[model samples]
Target chain A: MIIGALGPEGSYSEKAVQIWILRHRLDSVGIQYFADIEDAFLAVIQKKSDLSIVPIENSIEGSVGVTLDLLHENGVEIVGEIVVKIEHCLLSKGGPEKIKVILSHPQGLAQCRHFLKKYFPEAELRSTGSTSHAARLAGEFEEMAAIASPEAAECYRLKVLLPNIQDRKQNYTRFIALRAAGKNTAEQVFEQVLCDTEEKTNRPENSSHSAFKTSIIVYLEKDRPGALYEILGAFAKNKINLTRIESRPSKKELGDYHFYIDFEGHISDAIIKETLKDIKTKTDTLKILGSYPAFKA
Target chain B: MIIGALGPEGSYSEKAVQIWILRHRLDSVGIQYFADIEDAFLAVIQKKSDLSIVPIENSIEGSVGVTLDLLHENGVEIVGEIVVKIEHCLLSKGGPEKIKVILSHPQGLAQCRHFLKKYFPEAELRSTGSTSHAARLAGEFEEMAAIASPEAAECYRLKVLLPNIQDRKQNYTRFIALRAAGKNTAEQVFEQVLCDTEEKTNRPENSSHSAFKTSIIVYLEKDRPGALYEILGAFAKNKINLTRIESRPSKKELGDYHFYIDFEGHISDAIIKETLKDIKTKTDTLKILGSYPAFKA
Candidate 1:
């Protein structure tokens, strides 16, 4: 399998993908890099990669807007999710004392600002494509160091000038793995079959039940009062608890927002599917991003 | 008045403050530098600077969460706002062709990612504290360049490797000048005048009409259904229009938010004041942040 991620070696996206790849021992998977998340999605849409890893949210930063924006515009299904605990490190080309300058992504730098100020108070802070790229650049320059992930140091062969350099110890990133539509990619690792064959046969002969959570994006028919209330009423009427609902301004029109909603239950569930059918009639557009078992953070 | 901004040069924040300073040129005003916006605010809170200038929002990036968070926490109050149009330039230590690396703030770098891919496809992209800081470091080294404001090149004594390097021409930032909560201490360059003085005098002496906007932060008495709605209804009953309302998770308690609100007029106006008093009765706590003329962005 080919996996595409935001890269030029050590971005948070790259680090996230690397950690997941390592944990899953998917070593044979071909990995490709893109300059941005949109490009990474295009790589998947154009069939350049079988699966792609994109950061969905950071504990400190909240949501990755670009990732959500692309998910809205592109057609892809979230098959799996990886929540990796992030520990940003300060890396250098040579020894810690030899480091004259530091480089990292803005968020990475922000996360480690307190550390950088305390330790490298006199050193200049620089921004690189990603923490990984910064690590690689640090390795090439005699006076440079990087603020990035430990995975970055391993990738670029740099020494860890400082460890656990981030301001927060609970730094975590949630990444989503995307595969082609209609693919049943949910792992049995976290799933428990709720059906007993004998009991199932005693009921409806072909009946089946599986616990699932659904994700959907809806564009309002127009910008008007009570539009959101009407859209939300569907889930409320069906007694389906909404886990999350966020609004992103629709690119097609100013002041119009596309709402991304996540709720318990599968799209195939009788009540959910019925509510969705009514919701489709009320909304300008409705697209299901996925219906996978919820991953507990 | 001594104004502290993120500097060592021409950065978006620096240019933003410079534009406001030169235009206002408060009598006997001076400028100082801080590592970042948070430090700039700290300068005022710690009595190190009389005033501080910091970016609160960007056209594309929405709100600067850090700035908003600072405003919510610091004892400082926003006195004024200025909108500065952003123009990004590509600079190099040697020359454009000699530029093997490009450095800038992540937001700046993200805005110009398309341009980078189109032109300097092979040049490495880097991040920094600010565009000004990037220019400062790029000037000290050769082969490395920076994407920063044109003023950055002049301030750092570096040449503009390339002009108009940003992908879009409409990048702009809205900056707010903050000072410790006290009666105007430095000078009265600008005063919070009524938006419409005619309406104030024309109304009966006891009339409740107001011509200024007031901002307030409130904490809920308890987490329960209809609490926010009941609080907001106080204004609605008085025909007061709520211009903006947002909730930020109050880190102190789980599932509780501190609501930031902006209403049509000042607390001095009887109707608005009465509405706030009524809200105060229902809310656990309410603090008026400021009452100023509504800013047009």
Candidate 2:
């Protein structure tokens, strides 16, 4: 089995994959790393990997907009989720006091802003393509340090001069594992997928997977005074709870948008099916991304 | 009078200010440049500048999350708006064939992806803090080029090797001019504010000024099944058209969020006032960012 994720080997995406591996105890898995979220997602589409892991949202920064956009652009279905606590370590070849520059991914740098200002106010801050890329560069310069994953420090042979330097300790990132959408997808083979998950966790098969959530995208046929209200009413009338709702520009006009929404309930449920039926009547386009068990439990 | 914007003198924020200046015909205003959006906004809050202009949203990129978060962090009221079309120019000292690296702000590079893939498939793409910053560096290297505003090309003394290189011709950015919130702000002195916008556009003062839009951020007391539905009900029942609605993390937890909403009608309107009253009852927190005229003619 080959699993794809965003790379240079030390990304939090890789960490999420590791967490999944431990849960499933997969021994025959090979890891493939891609340059970006889209590329990682494409690995599944292109048949290079059986599954792809993607960082979906962050507790501090917000949704990874590009990841959301790519999910919409591709025909991938999310099958599983791994929520990882994000911990950035200030790494260096020498003492922290000797470091003249700090390199990291932009988000990493933003997460450590308070720490950086309080400690290395004069150090030059630079952004790299990935945190591990920064880690690799940090190893080459004695006066440089990096904010990255501990896995990256190990891979780059750099010491963790300081640990968990993020401004917020509770910061977490949600990564979803995706596979190509089609006949063998989650809905069609729900029982088999549960069996696979059951083998990993050593849990009972009949533990009530009632917290399944469905993802969908809706586009309005025309701009009206209460177009969105009419759509949301469908869910509200059925007592369906929405977990998330975000609007992205359709790129055709300023006011027009495509709404990405996640609501509680599996698509197989009668109420959810009815709600989607009503949504379809009011929307110009409706795409059911997938139904997956919520990570909350 | 002074206007603050993010700049090395040629950013899109700077261009947004120039558009506002032309529309208002402000001749005596000095332009102040800051390293980032926070600093530019801080200039107004710290009383170093009377007002600051910020890029609030882009047609292609969606809302500027940092700008939205900063507004919530500070006591700034959006007093006016300026919408400027974004046009990227491929700037370089040498021919396109000689360019080996393309540098730009991430958004700039994304906007010109089609152009880059077509013309410079092999050129390495790099991200910068700002497009103008990339242009400044591009000017120093003959083998490097940047995608920046035409104004940036002028400031950096680089040739516009290609014009209008943005993938979308309709790409535009909406900028809002902000001032300190208080009795002296637009709300307390609504008449004077309209007079100001009216004089700048050479229009009669009494078109009712009904085109005003108000921005607010709301946080639910707790995550409830119909919490957001109840909040949207306030605007829907009142027949207020929501121009934009986005959710950002409250930084407290994963599900908790700050919903930034923009809708038609100012706070001065009777229906909008009633809506806020009812909304406040249902929400744990409500912040009235400000009311401003919509950029629509």
Could you say which candidate leads in lDDT? 2
In order, candidate lDDTs are: 0.68, 0.79
Best by TM-score: 2
Model 1 alpha-carbon drift over 4 Å, by segment: A6-39, A93-95, A140-142, A151-161, A180-265, A269-288, B18-26, B91-95, B136-142, B150-165, B182-289
Model 2 - which docking category? medium
Tell me the number of clashing residue pairs for each predicted model: 7, 0
Relative to the real complex, the DockQ score for model 1 comes to: 0.18
Top of the candidates by DockQ: 2
Chain A vs. native, model 2, TM-score: 0.86
DockQ values, each candidate:
0.18, 0.52
**Which 10 residues in a row give candidate 2 chain B its minimum summed lDDT?**
B195-204
